[model samples]
Target chain A: DQQVKQNSPSLSVQEGRISILNCDYTNSMFDYFLWYKKYPAEGPTFLISISSIKDKNEDGRFTVFLNKSAKHLSLHIVPSQPGDSAVYFCAASAINNDMRFGAGTRLTVKP
Target chain B: DVKVTQSSRYLVKRTGEKVFLECVQDMDHENMFWYRQDPGLGLRLIYFSYDVKMKEKGDIPEGYSVSREKKERFSLILESASTNQTSMYLCASSYPGTSGFSSYNEQFFGPGTRLTVL
Candidate 1:
């Protein structure tokens, strides 16, 4: 069974607009969440992370919101640029367990 | 910068052949992981090692074995290559956290090796 899930396979947004990508999880033991972005032919790079204690974390143009009670999280990018187009993966993990990743969501920011 | 280097960027092997994929991390990290990435499957861990000579099975470990003789290098061995094993293999490394929450540590990944078993 998939513990983490990204219901949307892809998302498209216009430049300078806001893009929202959602993820859900079934495991309650997950206390930390992270987002990784990947471009074609490259490895994934860490984007932002949030601890279970916090509901939100932001880095520059990217923001990650976590709702522990609802077992959901969303990644928001404001003023999305064409360079922001890539695959986004949501991962969750406990203190001792390896992070479980969702099937990534492809984000396309149109010029 | 943390650098994780894989032995190969691409490899092709025939069925029943023994294949070895090597990974090296320059970060002096204690944790190393091997994962296979498929189109819709994202990334699935095949094996992981927390310390030299210590290894753990991940979500999918069948037909795979690993070795960590040195702290900087980890090797994944395919006992018998199969067509279904063709996929992109990724290597990642991270340091153990003092807070006992190792998952909080960000993992640095290699460029990945695309293995094709025919």
Candidate 2:
């Protein structure tokens, strides 16, 4: 069973537009959530993360919103750039630190 | 910056051959993890360690074993590599499991080792 799910496999957005990626989880025990961005042939890099206590967290152009009640979280990239195009993954972890990752959403920023 | 390195970026092996995958982290983090990534399946955990000589089985650990002898290193072993085991293997490290949400607790992944078994 997929405890964490990214229903959208791919998303396309025009350059300078906003890109939003969504993720949902079935495990309510998960209290910490994170986003990772990966480029081809490279390891995934940490993007943004949000805590269960807070609904929103922002890091420059990247922002993550957590909806505890809905078991959903989202990543928002404003004025998306070409470099921002990549496979984005959302991961959730309970108190145990064993993280479960979603299938990932490929973000394509068209120039 | 912390860097997690896998011993090989790619490997090819024959069925029944014993295989060893190594990983090392420079961040001195206490937690390390092994995961296999397959297309459409995302990343599936194979094993993880929180301290030397301590290990735990993950979501898909049927064909894998792990060893953590030192603080900075963790290893994954395949007793007899099989065709179905062929996939990109990744190593990651982070601080101890967090009970609360913290962005800095994000795990850092290695470049990944692509293994092909025939």
Candidate 3:
């Protein structure tokens, strides 16, 4: 069973606009959530993450929000740039355990 | 900078052939993992190792095996290649966090190898 899920397969946004990618998880034991961005023919890179204890964490233009009660999380990128277009994956894991990944969402930023 | 390196960027193999995909990390990470990426199915964990000479089966381990004889190197093996095994393979490594939550350490990934089995 897939414990982590990304409902949307793709998301398109205009450059300089806010892009929101959402994820949901069925496993409540997950305490850490992470987002990874992947470019064509490249490996997934670590993006942003949020701990279950905190509701939100931000780093410059990227932010991750976690709603533990709802078992949901979202990645927000402000002023999206054309270079930001890539496949984004959401993953969650319990302490010291292997992570569960979502199917992934492809984000397209139009200039 | 943290770096994980894979043996191949792409490979083609025939059915019944044995294949080896090797991964090495320069970051001195204690945990290493192998995952296969396929369309729609996303990234499925094949195998992982938390220490030298130790291995654990992930979500999908059938027909696949892994080796971690050293801390920096991990190998994924396909005993008898099949068409269904064609996919992109990713290797990742992460440090064991001080808090005992290995997930706390961000995983660094290699460029990945695209393997095609006929």
**What is the C-alpha lDDT profile of model 1 across B4-118, one tens digit per residue?**
9999999999999999999999989999999998877888999999999999999999999999999999999999999999999999999898864377788888989999999
Please write out the lDDT profile of model 2 over residues B21-51, one tens digit for every residue. 9999999998899999898788999998888
Candidate with more favorable, higher DockQ: 2 or 3: 3
The lDDT of model 3 is 0.93
Error of model 3, residue B6, in angstroms: 0.6
Question: What ranking of all candidate models by TM-score puts the best one first?
Answer: 1, 3, 2
* Ten residues in sequence with the least summed lDDT for candidate 3 chain B: B97-106
The C-alpha stretches of model 1 lying farther than 4 A from their native spots are B99-101
Q: Model 1 residue B78 lDDT?
A: 98
What is the alpha-carbon lDDT of model 1 when measured against the actual structure? Answer: 0.93
User: In model 2 chain B, where is the ten-residue run with the lowest total lDDT?
Assistant: B96-105
Candidate 1 at A4: error in angstroms?
A: 0.6
Candidate 2 error regions (>4 Å) = B97-104
Question: Candidate 1: deviation at residue B110, Å?
Answer: 0.5
